[model samples]
Target: MDPNEHSNRLSTEFISLVEKINTLSNRTRSSEQPFLGALEQWRIESQQTLDSFCNEKRQTFINSRLEELNRLRTNVEELACVQDVTQQNTNSIKTSIDRIEQDINKIQFNFRPLLIDEHLIVRRSQDLLPFPPSNQAIELTDSSYAVLAGNKQHLLVHREPTLCLLDRQLTIIKETSWPLDDISDICWSSVLNRFIVINSQYVFILDERTMVLEQCLTSDTVNWIRGTCSDTKLYLSTEGIGSSIFEYTLMPSIVLLKEWKSPVTCAHNEWIEDLKFHNDFLGLVIGRCKNNAVCFELRSTVTLNCLWSIQLEEVCSMYATRCCPMLNHQWIVVAFRNPRIFHISSGGKLISADKKCRSPSNICQIGSNLLAIWDQKCIYLQNLCCII
Candidate 1:
């Protein structure tokens, strides 16, 4: 009764103790699983943070290097332009030197001695030359020589942010300050009796009499090179990937008609230098590198058909072109480098040339004479022709 019962009871108690220990171990294992999961999640988040920081640093370095390279490239391009201009000036000086040398050689070899006591009186007369007398000139403040436009009665001059209307005597009759950012070019429309002013982004129409801003028009393309207006439409020259002319009708509602591009093959880098319109013809002065310029005339309407084209020579710079209405034959005045003026026929023939004006930038017909601005400061009134 004593030994067997005691041994059985001890065995049962040992078995119970084993069951309780197993339950405690299972609970401890379950609790440790959640802690281990939380620890693993923390480790993963730390790794992601470190990776993101490293990527950010790498991208920043790359962007900084790209910006620096772009700046350097811009500087190099500027240097190249300066070098080209320097070379051009050097060549110009060399040509002048050669001309002077040739003149000296002619004087040395083919000298003609003047007769003594013979009075040689050179008669001065306006009939001898085509240019009119330099009657009036007025200096302006930082004016662009390319901003001369108008008819025979009034001359419109743009002095940046301001426009000046002058009389035949080169006196400023009216002055109006432009409210826009800048003005790239200006033209007068006799039919609309308004002045068209253009910037790179917008075109502004102004009343001729009151000189008040009338209407503003915008274009999809940027960089408007020049503008011209007819009786019923306005023509704009815009330059981007290529050169193009955008036409807008000036009726009840301003409507975009169409865009015109030159059918003539042009280099991808070609740009428009100047634009002019006369009668039913539109003239475009296109330029590339120095001495690479072409004058083209096409139909002034939406349907562009090339009538004539002429490549210009000895033109270091081509700035502006104007159609002359007083002449019987179609003639346009083209201003070239060193401010030389050339009369070009519609058929591309080089007519009379004038190099008397210093740094002529623009030309227009005023009365029976040609009015031109020189060096962005002085204005000259010269006869269109001296022959009777």
Candidate 2:
């Protein structure tokens, strides 16, 4: 009985020791797992602090660089603004200098005055021959020495035609008499080298050098004649019954090439006072109907046609009409018998109207900036500045 009991007790004690060793092993494993977890948490926290410090350093560097760039941009903008202002001031100074120079030049030029003087040296009564004795004394034609006058009063000057030449002082240099009748108007033809005398029905062209008759043309009563050397054409204005007006042209061969009736018609017995050729196409005809200035144009085939006509406001009678070329042919100055001057375009548009002289009989260009206006008693030299 004793042996069996001891063995059983020993086996029980051994079992208890083995169970205690297993429980201690389990406790150690659980305590070690918690310490390892705490160490891992400390490592993660250190890494986060390092990353935060690095990020703050990077932000400071970026802010410093951005401030430097902004300062550089502001400096550049200020420099550009200063440069622009300097350039503008320089340009303003240059313009002012140029204007001052121009003003000085103008002042210097205007400081001096132009002087003109006329001297009369001689006077003689018989030395000056009167205009040819005719019925109306309508027109005059001149050669180098001879002047042929025509009129409509009685045509007596043609039956006993008188020719006269005068010097600059209007002193008679030569005189001649010819036998003819019924002369109406006279014109000098540079192309034919002749003097043409137009009667009521015929045109007589006399050679200027030889003083011999060259050709004769017969038509209605002629009122005016104008010669053009470029086309070798002579324009003639004829008076018809009543207010009818007709025009004709003579060619180089003294043959009538064109004849046409004017579109402008006057009242009963209205007459054209003067006729002038401004150029090849433009013509001026002054008449008494309402005191109007009639303008005509030579169109295709040199047929005389009316473009536009204007009646002056204050003039009741017109005696002469002439065109003064100016401004490189851009403008024309027309002078009427009532001393009214008008600046008109080539197309018959009136630009300005004013009185220029007192009783101006004839108006002609004497120089680049002057006009010579003559009356029955005196001649005036006028400065035409605004018109030019």
Candidate 3:
């Protein structure tokens, strides 16, 4: 090589090394300091987790006490039935008294003050604006409908002629046309790493990575309305009165696991508009056919037995009701026909409700602290708050 060429090459290499070193210095902020900052953030998050765990335990303890008291009351009531009008044998009376006494003793023990860390509590924000925050929304075509949260920080949306994948910021990543019609609902199957899309008669799976769509012949032919998925199972509900929910396995094929129908699903006159599964429980929205009487029910996914039911208003609508999972096993639901949003506990208790938003049709939590809500024409992104 020429002497001048070698000298220029050495000079270029030296400059490049210095630039790389500067970049590393900027990224690490002197190595140990950046790591220490990250450690502090993790510590704060760990404390938050501990606080939440303590809160849940306190609630569980209270619920157990209430259940035990109910049992004791029932036992006493039965003991009172020892009226001569009703024949109560000596053995039966003794057994009832023993049961009541045992329950009373247990209740007395639990009635004592609990020693726990009650540091974490949720409160409604002072500026609880029920409308879209900062008007951060994306407009869609008139034919667009339905939005669902995917595994990553992305969303699946259906428009008139195509299906689109969007990031948390409501920016479209890709759109494809597989010619689907009457798209009822879409759910992400974490086990399959794909999306399960349901219409009235067919089930489709879309690969989020490739944006490819395909039909699942294994799915049953039914009038499907809305759907939700667990890690291992895909659950779809039907479209009419006395709507039935079908459970299918996520492996091998979308094979049938169990088919739940009314009154196990809901009363004969009620419609199953929306359903979501969180952990071991299933949340259902059942609406009366002829009127606007709607109820949110929590049930066991294993036994399909009702756990608790809470009455709600202005939710059942021309569009199916929505149920999105919230942190700590809570749910955020919407009133589509009217403009109302609700926060509910895992045990079917109303935490709070916002009588704002204009014609809110659907809602889904995008990431941990962000929320995505949509109506007919636009989708809004907002900072999620745990409103009391």
Please tell me which predicted candidate would have the highest lDDT against the true structure: 3
Deviation (Å) of 277 in candidate 1: 1.3
Candidate numbers, best TM-score first, in rank order = 3, 1, 2
lDDT of 3 by residue, 211-274 (tens): 9888883344568888888888888888788889898898877788889988889888888878
lDDT of 1 at 163: 84
* Per-residue lDDT over 1-388 for candidate 1, one digit per residue giving the tens place of the 0 to 100 score: 6999999999999999999999888876773664455546766987898799879977875676566556555655676678456666556556655665565467443436634332321222223124555767777667443576777688888765578888878788888987766677888776667778787887777776898876577766567878877777878887543677778887765678877765432345676666677666666666656554545444535455567666666554535444343343455554546555666655666666667746666666665455554455666776444322
Error of 3 at 149 (Å): 3.1
Highest TM-score against the true fold, candidate:
3
Clashing residue pairs, candidate 3?
124-388
> lDDT tens digits, residues 260-335, model 2?
4534433444444444444455344445544354432222225445565555454534344544444223234344
Stretch of 10 with least lDDT, candidate 2 = 150-159
Ranking by lDDT: 3, 1, 2
What are the clash counts of all predictions, listed in order? 0, 7, 1
- Please report the TM-score between candidate 1 and the true structure: 0.60
